[model samples]
Target: MKKIYVTLALSVALLLGSCGNKNNETSNDEAAIAVEVNQTTENQTNALLSVSGKIQSSNSADLSTRMMGYINKVYVNVGDQVKKGQMLVSVNSVDLMAQKAQVDAAIVQATVAFNNAEKDYKRFKNLFADNSASQKEMDDISANYEIAKAQLEAAKQKKNEVNAQLAYTNITAPFSGTITTKYIEVGDMANPGMPLISIEVQDDYEVMAMVPESEISQVEKGTPVDVLVKSINRTVKGKVQEVSTSAKNTGGQFLVKIALEKTDAPILSGMFTTVQFPITQKSDTQMVLVPVDAIIHDGQLSGIYTVSQSNTAILRWLRLGRIFGDQVEVLSGLKADEIYIVSADGKIYNGAKIKY
Candidate 1:
C-alpha cells in the first residue's frame, strides 16, 4: 500500500507541472499577437491649411495751407466727411481786405494818369504836324505817355496778386475723405506749410507684406492672403495687388501690396495686423486620399515607401507636390489605392514586415 500511494503522488505532480507550463506559453503568445496588431494600424496624419493677412486704405492726405492767416471758421471737424475740393477752414480776411483796398486805390490812380497822358499825346501829335512843336518835344511827350500806360498795367498785376492771396485764406479738401485730425480751433492763427488736419480715404484699402526672394517665384498678383486684427477681432482676406520689382530692407525680401476685400465693419486706420500667405496649394480630395506616413527625406531628395504584391514595403523614390498642413502630395512614383506604412514612434524601415 505504501508503494502504490508514492507512485500515484509522483504522477499527479508531473501532470500539473506540464499543464502550468503550457498555459504560460499560451498567455505570452496572445500578448505578442495583440502588440503586433496595434503596431500595424497606427498612422500619423496631416490636414488642410488656411492663409492669414490685413486691411488698409490706399489714399490719405494732410490738410495744410501755403498762406498764413487767422482761422475764421473750421468747416469740418474730426470725423467729418468731405468731398474733393470742398472747403475745410476759412482764414481771417483782415490782411487780405487791406491788400485789396490798396490795389483798388492804385488802380484808380493809374487810370487817371493814363487818361491825362493820352490827352497830352494827342495834343503833341497835332502840334508836331503844324510845326508848332519840335521833334524832341513830341518824343518827350510820347515817352511820358508810355510810362503812364506801363504804370496802369502794373496796378492791374497788383490787384491780381491781392485776389490770389484772398483765395488762399479759404482752405479746402484735396480729396474725398473723413477728417481724422483737427489741430486748429476757431480764431487760431494758421501758418504756411503747417498741418491743420488729416483726411484719410477708407473706400480703398491695401495691406503691405514682405515676401522673401526665396518664395518670390510662388508669389504673383491676385494671390489671396489672410489678415487678422485682435483689437476689434476683425478677420479679413486680401489679394496681391503689387509686388516690388526691387528688394526691400530685408536681406532679400520684396514689398508686396495686398488689396483687402472691403467690409462694412469699422476698421480704424493703421491698426496692427497679423498676416499669412500660402506658398503652395493642395486639393482637398488629393490630401484626403494620400497616406500620412512613408515620407522620407535625405539631403535634397524626398520619397516614401511602396508595397509590392507580396506586401513587402519598398523604399521607392517619389516627387512631392503641394504640401497642405501635415499632408504632402506625391507627384510621381506613387499610384492611387496603394498601401503605405505609417510610423508610430518615427521608427520605420523598408522590408519591415508589418502585418496589416
Candidate 2:
C-alpha cells in the first residue's frame, strides 16, 4: 500500500509540471509589440490656405485681323520672339492697291481744276475792283472757284479713307511677346476678327486660382503668397494682384490672380501649381497636423493607427484637410492629447499588442 501511494504522488506531480509549461508558452506569445508612438499636439502657425492653381502669362492675347482676304504670307512662326509693331502676317491686298491707285488719280485731277479756278477767281476779283466786270460775272467766277475747292477736298478725304482700309490688310504685333500659336498658313482665308496668332509675355508669369466663397473674404489684394510649381518642384514668391468681388461668372468661386516674382527657375505657362495664402489665425484657434506617411488609405477612407489604453493598435478614421508641405491637416477624429503610432516594426492590426 505504501509503494502504490508513492507512485500515485509522482504521477500527480508530473501532470502539474506539464500544465505549468503550457501556461508559460501562451504568456510568451502575448508579448508587447515594438512600435514608434507620437503624442498629438496643436501648433500656432500662420494658417495657410492651399489651392490648386495654374501658371500663365499676365499679358496674353490672340492676335486677329479685321479684313477678309486670302493670307499672302506669315512673317512670324510659332515660338518666335517679336517686337511691338512687327509685321506678323500679310493678306492679299491687290484689290486695296487698285483702289488706292484710283484715289490718287482722282486727287491729281481735282488739284489741277482747283489751281485753274483759283487763278480765274483772282482775275475776276481784280476786274470787279476796277469796275471792268459786271456783278453777275464776278459772282459766277467766285461760285466756280468754291465748287472746285470743295471737289478737291472731297477727293482728298476719299484717299484718306482708302488709306485707312489698306492698313487692315497688314497684321502687326500689338506688343512684344513670344508667339505661342499660329492659326493661319499661306493661302488660308482670313476673315474679320479671325485669330491669326497667340502671343504671351513669357518672362512675366502669374498664377490663376479659384477660392471658395467662404474663403474669398479672407484674401485681399497685395497680400504676399507662395506658389509651388509641382512640375519643377519649386516655390516662388508672389503677390496677390486681384481678388474678384463677385462670384457671378466663376461658378460660385472667386478668382484670384497672383503675380510671381522673378526667378531663375524654368516656369512655363500652363504649369500646375499650389498656391499658399498666409492667413492670420486667432489666438484661441490651433491646427492639428500629422505626417503624411503615417496616414493609411483604404479606398476613399483615410485613417491612422492609434495607441489604445491597453497598448494595442486602434485604427481611427480621420477627416483630413489640405496638405502643408510633408504634413497634412487633421480636421477631426484625432484628439490633440491622444497618442498615435507613427510606425511599427511588425504588422499592426486592431487589438494587436504594441509598446511605445
Candidate 3:
C-alpha cells in the first residue's frame, strides 16, 4: 500500500513540472514578439513624374506652286538655307511664253482694226460735210469706230493677265528657312496646289506637348517651362507662349507651347520632348517621393512601413500630397535618408515580418 501511494505522488509531481514547462514556452514567444516590435525601420525616397511630347516650331510650311509646268530648275536642294524671296524652283517657261505670244498677236490685230476704223471715220466726216454722205451713214461709221477701240482695250487686259501667270512659274521662298524636303526632280511636273517642298524657319522654335486639361490651369501664357529632349537627353529652359483655351474634343487634352530661349542648339525638329512647369501645389515640387506601393492607406489615413531591425514592419503614419506617375509625394511620413519596403506579392500589414 505504501508503494502505491509513492507512485501516485511521483505522477502528480511530474504533471505539475510539465505544466510549468509549457507556461515558460508561451511566455518566451510573447517576449520575442515584443522585442520584434521595438526595432526601428527607415525609408529613402525620390520624386519622379512621366510626361512625353514632340519638338516643333511655329514656322513650318508645305511649299506648293500655283501654275502647272515642267520643273526646269531646282535652285535649292534639301538642307539649303534660303533667304526670303529667294527663287527655290523654276518651271519651264515655254508655256508661259506661248501664252504671252498669243496675247501680243491679239493686241496687234486689235490695233490694226482701230486704225482702219479711224481712217474710215475721217473719210466719212469729209463726205458728210460735202453732203455726199447721209446722216444714218455717218452714225453707222462712228459706231464701228467705237467698237474697234473697245476690242483693243480688251486685248491689252488679256495680255496683262497672261504676263502675271508667267511670273508664278518661278517658285520663291516666302520666308527664310532651310528646306527639309524637295518632292520633285528637275523634270517632274509642277502641279498647282501640290506640295513642292517642306521648309521650316530656323529662328523660331517651340516644344509641343499635350497636357491633360486638369493641368492647364497651372500653366499660363508667359509662364516658365523646362523642356527635356529625350533624343539628346538634354534640357532647355523656355516659357509657355500659348495655352489652348478649350480642351481637345478627342482626348480631353490641351495643347501647350513652350517657346525655347534661343540657343546655338543643333537640335532639329520633330524630336520627342517633355515639358515641366512649376505647379502651385507643393506635391508637384516635392524633393522626396516614393513608389505608391510603399504607401499604405487606412480609411483617410496614409502610412508606410519601414522594415524594423528585427525583420518586422512598423507602420508610420504619413501626410501625402500630389501623385505623379507611380510615385507619391511623402509630405510627412518619410525621411530622405531611410529605406522603405516595396512589395511584389502585395500582402503586407502594419506589423508583418519582412525578409528584404
Candidate 4:
C-alpha cells in the first residue's frame, strides 16, 4: 500500500509530538515569584474600639460558707498567699462546740440570779429610806429587782448569740488575697452559699469588657484604655473604671470596667484581654489594615496572597476583623488600594507569576 501510508504518517507525527511536550510542561506563564508587596492600609487613626476582655482581680471574692458543715479544714491551697485575718476554712466546730456548751450553762445560771437580785435591790433601797420598806413593800421589791436584772441581760445576750455562731465555724481571709479557687475539699460538704474559696486581689488588675448597646454610647467614665494581654504578649495601661448604665444583665452587652494602670506586667487573674476603645470615627470611615504577617491560615480558612492584574498569585479568602496591633482587620476580602503578598521569594501558587 505505500508502506501503509508511511506507517500512518509516523503515527500522526508521534501524536503531535507528545502533545507539544505536554504544552510546555503545564505552563500558566510560570517563572516569576519574587514577591513582597503590601498596599492595603486606610486606618485613619483615632477610632480604636477593640473589646473582648477578661483579666480580673480588682479584688475578687467567692469564698462562701455561712453555716453548713463538714469541710473541717481546707486552710488555703490554690496558690495560697493569704493574710488579712488569715485562716482559710475550717467548718466542723462540733456543732459550734455544742452550742458553746449550752451558752456556758446559761451563763452560770444567769450569774446566780444576778447576785440574788442585787441583794434584794439594796435591801429595798435601805428599807424604803427609813419607812422600813412599804410603798407596797418597795413596789414588790422593785419588781423582783427588775426581774433579776432582766434575767442577767438575757444570759449575756445568749453568750453573744453563741459567740456569733462561733464565727461561722471559722473561714477568715477577707482581703489580702491570692487563693484563686479551691471550692472545698477536706471531706467536702460545705453548703450555705457553697463557693468555699476563690480569692484574688494580688497586684490589682481589671478588665471585664462587654460593650454593645450599640457601642454603649461610646464608653465614657475616664476613658484611657489599651489592655491587650492575650496571654502575656502584654500591652497594659487602662482606665475606664465601670460604665454599665443598664443592659439588663449583660446579654445586651454593656458592662465596661477597665482599671489596670500600675502594672509590672505578670497580670494573672483569668488573663485573655483586648480592650483598646478610643472611639470617635465619622469622617468617611474606611478601615482596611492588613499585615498580621500576611495571614493565610487554612484550617479555619483565612487567606491573603492577592496581586492579580495578570501579575497572578490571587488567593484572597479573608473576612477577619479586630486585632489592630500588628495589624489585621480586613473584614471581607481586602480592599483599600489592594496588592497584598507581603513576603514570598519563591513558592506561591494560583497561576503563580508574582514579581514585586
In terms of TM-score, the best-performing candidate is 2
By descending lDDT, how would the candidates be arranged? 2, 4, 3, 1
TM-score winner between candidates 2 and 4: 2
Query: Which clashing pairs does model 4 show?
Result: none
TM-score of each: 0.54, 0.74, 0.61, 0.42
* Residue-level error in angstroms, candidate 2, position 14: 11
lDDT of 3 by residue, 1-356 (tens): 99999999999999999999999977755433222112222323332233566777679888887899898988988899998899988888897798899989999999999999999999999999999999999999999999999999999999888878877888888889899999999999988899988888877788888777656677789977677787787888888888888774638888877888888756788888877666554444435567776677899998877766776767889897655555666778677766666652445676764554
lDDT of 1 at 19: 96
Name the TM-score of candidate 1: 0.54
- The residue-by-residue lDDT of candidate 4 on 125-195, one tens digit each, is 99889888779878887888788788878878988987787787787888887887897688888878888
Please provide, for model 2 over 121-173, each residue's C-alpha lDDT reduced to its tens digit, 9 standing for 90 to 100.
99999999999999999999999999999999999999998888778888888
Instruction: List per-prediction Cα lDDT, in the order shown.
Output: 0.72, 0.90, 0.77, 0.82
Residue 150, candidate 1: alpha-carbon lDDT: 98
Which lDDT value does model 2 have at 144? Answer: 94
Of candidate 4, the 10-residue stretch with the lowest lDDT total is 24-33
After best superposition, candidate 4 residue 105: deviation in angstroms?
A: 1.2
- Tell me how far the alpha carbon of residue 105 in candidate 1 is from the true structure, in angstroms, after superposition: 1.3
Stretches off by above 4 angstroms in model 4 are: 1-22, 30-48, 54-61, 65-90, 106-108, 126-128, 131-158, 161-163, 166-182, 185-207, 210-218, 221-241, 244-278, 282-288, 291-338, 341-356
State candidate 3's TM-score.
Answer: 0.61
Model 2: lowest-lDDT 10 consecutive positions: 24-33
In angstroms, give how far residue 263 of model 3 lies from its true place: 1.3
